[model samples]
Target: MPGSEHADRTEDGLSIPRHRVLVTGATGLLGRAVYKEFHNNKDWHALGTGHRRARPRFLRCDLLDEDAVKAVIRDFRPDVIVHCAAERRPHVVERNAEAAVDLNVKATATLAKEAAASKPGAFLIYISTDYVFDGRDPPYGEDDTPEPLNLYGKSKLDGEREALRHCPAVAILRVPVLYGEVEHVEESAVTALWDQVQEGAAGSCMLDHCQQRFPTEVRDVAVVCRALAERQRQDPSSVRGIFHYSAKEQMTKYEMAVAIAQAFHLPASHLMPLTEQPAGAGARRPLNAQLACCRLRQLGLDVQPRPFRTAITDCLWPFLPDKRWRQTVFF
Candidate 1:
C-alpha cells in the first residue's frame, strides 16, 4: 500500500499488516466526512484527492484527466478507492451538461478502469445519490426501479453502470441529504438553516416545500462507508450491489424546516410553507427519493435510523446562538 507505514516487524523482519486507501473528492461535504473517518485510523494509510487546493497530504488532480488519475492509482497502489468526486450541483449540471457528463460519468468510468487494472483486488466504492429514483412514492427500496428526474441523478446512475463494467470489485452506496460539521463549516441542509437562525434571518425559517425525502446525517453515512470498506477487506467477493443509506423515516421539506426551527428554539412562524413545485432551472427532482434499506440490512449492515427531531437537534445544536431569537416572524 502506498501510504502505509510498517509499525512492527517479525523476527525475520517481515512488516506488520496495513491497508492503504485513497479517497477522491476530499473537499466536498460527504467526501470530507469519509476522509476524516479513514484518515485518522491507524490501520489505514489515507490519501485524499481534490481538484483545486491541496490540503496537506491530499493530491491535486482532476478526475477528468485520465492520465493524472491513472498515475495516482499506480503510484498510490491503494487497497481501496472511494470515488466521491463529481459535479454534484443539479442546476450546474443542467446548465453544463458536457462538464457534468465528463466529471460525473466519464471520470468515474476512467477511475474504475484504472483502479481495477492498477490494483486487481482493490475495492472501489462509488458514492451515489437517492435522486436516482423519482419520488413517486414513499420509502423506495434498493430493488425499486430508478427514474431519475434530473441530469445530475441520471449522470450518477450512468456512472454507476459504467463503473460496474470496469470494476467488478465494487460497491455502489446511494445516500440522501448529508448534514454535519467538518472543516469548521456547516454543509448540510440543517446546518444551512441553523446559520440563518444564528443570523436572525427569518427567511430561513419559512421556505418550506411539500416535496422532500429522508435526510441522513453525515456521521451515519460515514459509518456506512466504513462498514462497506471493512466488508470488502474481509471477503472481497461479498454481495456487491446498490445499497441505500438514509434516515429510515420520511419527511417533507416544510416539516424538516419546522423541525430545524424548533431545535434552534425559534418559532415555526418564521418559516414560509411553499407548495411543492418542480425545480425551475435545474432538472426536476424525484417526488419520492426515500430509499428502502432492506437489502442493506440483509447484508448485516443495518444502520439504526435516527428520529427526525433527534437528527434536527444533532445537526443544529452547534450553530444555535447563546441568546434567544425573536419568534414572531411570518410563516
Candidate 2:
C-alpha cells in the first residue's frame, strides 16, 4: 500500500499502490481539516463526502441513507474510513431527538457495518467529543468511564458503542472544543465568543468557573487523525480502540473570555461575568472536560498540539492576517 514501506517497488524502489482514505462530512469545520490533511499528503488518495454543499472534489453522500453508505464503501473500497458526520448542536438535538439518533448513532452504525465487510484490514475512525465526561473530574484518562450530561453527549456515547460493536477494532478520538479557520467562527463554541464581543456591544458572559475546558485546534486534531491512519497501515493493532486528544491547558469559559478579548482587542468591561446560568439553554453541560493525551504521545505519533496563546493566530488564520490586538469587527 502507499502508506506501507513494504509495498512492491518499481525500478527505482517507488511504491505503486496508494492508500485510499474516505472522510465523511467533508465540508464541515473539523471534517474539512481532516480531508485536507489526507489530500495534501502524497501517500494517500483522499475522497470526501458532502450533503448540502456540492463540489467536484466531494462525493455527495447522505449518511442517513444506509444504501448510500454501503454504495460509497463498496465502490471506493477505502482502506480507512474517518466518520465525522454528526448532529453536534446540543439544543438542536434536544428539539429534534429523532434526527439526532438517526444521524449520530444509526448512520455511524451503517458505516461501521459496511467497512467491516469491505476489507479485513479496513479501519473505522470515529470522531467523538469530550462531552462524554460530565465535567465532574479533571484530566480524564482514556480508561475513564463516560458520564455524559446531555443529548449530544449521549448520542456520541451511543455512537461509540455502535462503532465498537460493529467494527471491533475501531479507533475513536474524543476531543474538546475545536477552533480553526472555517466559514464562520460560530462552528466552534469558544471562538464564537468573538462574535459576541461586537464593537461597543455589552453582553453578559457566564461566570462558569466550575466548568473547565480546553479549546483544541481543528488542524491539530486532523494531524492526529492522519497520524493514526498512517500507523494503522503499518500496524493495524496498535491504532485500535479509544484515544483522547485535546489542548494542553484547561480554562473555564469565564477565564477564556478574558483571554479572547485580549487577543482580539475587544473590551472586557462590558462583557460582565454572571454567576447565574445563561437564559434559553436547553441542555446541561459538563463542568470540567480536560482530555489527557499521554497515551497518544507514547505511540510515537509526533503530535504536539500548539498552546492556546500561540494558537490564537491559527484559530483566526488568513481571515485576520495581522493577529495583533486590533479593534476590528469579525463576523
Local distance difference test, each candidate: 0.76, 0.81
lDDT by residue (167-229, candidate 1, tens digit) is: 888889998877666444345555565554444443544455766767777667877888888
- Model 1 segments more than 4 A misplaced: 1-17, 182-186, 195-205, 278-281, 306-331
Clashing residue pairs in candidate 2 are 135-288, 211-287
Error of 2 at 317 (Å): 5.9
lDDT of 1: 0.76
TM-score of 1: 0.86
Q: Residue 115: error of model 1 in Å? A: 1.6
- Model 2 root mean square deviation, Cα atoms: 3.6
RMSD of 1: 4.4
Encode model 2's per-residue lDDT on 128-151: one tens digit a residue. 999999877777888999999999
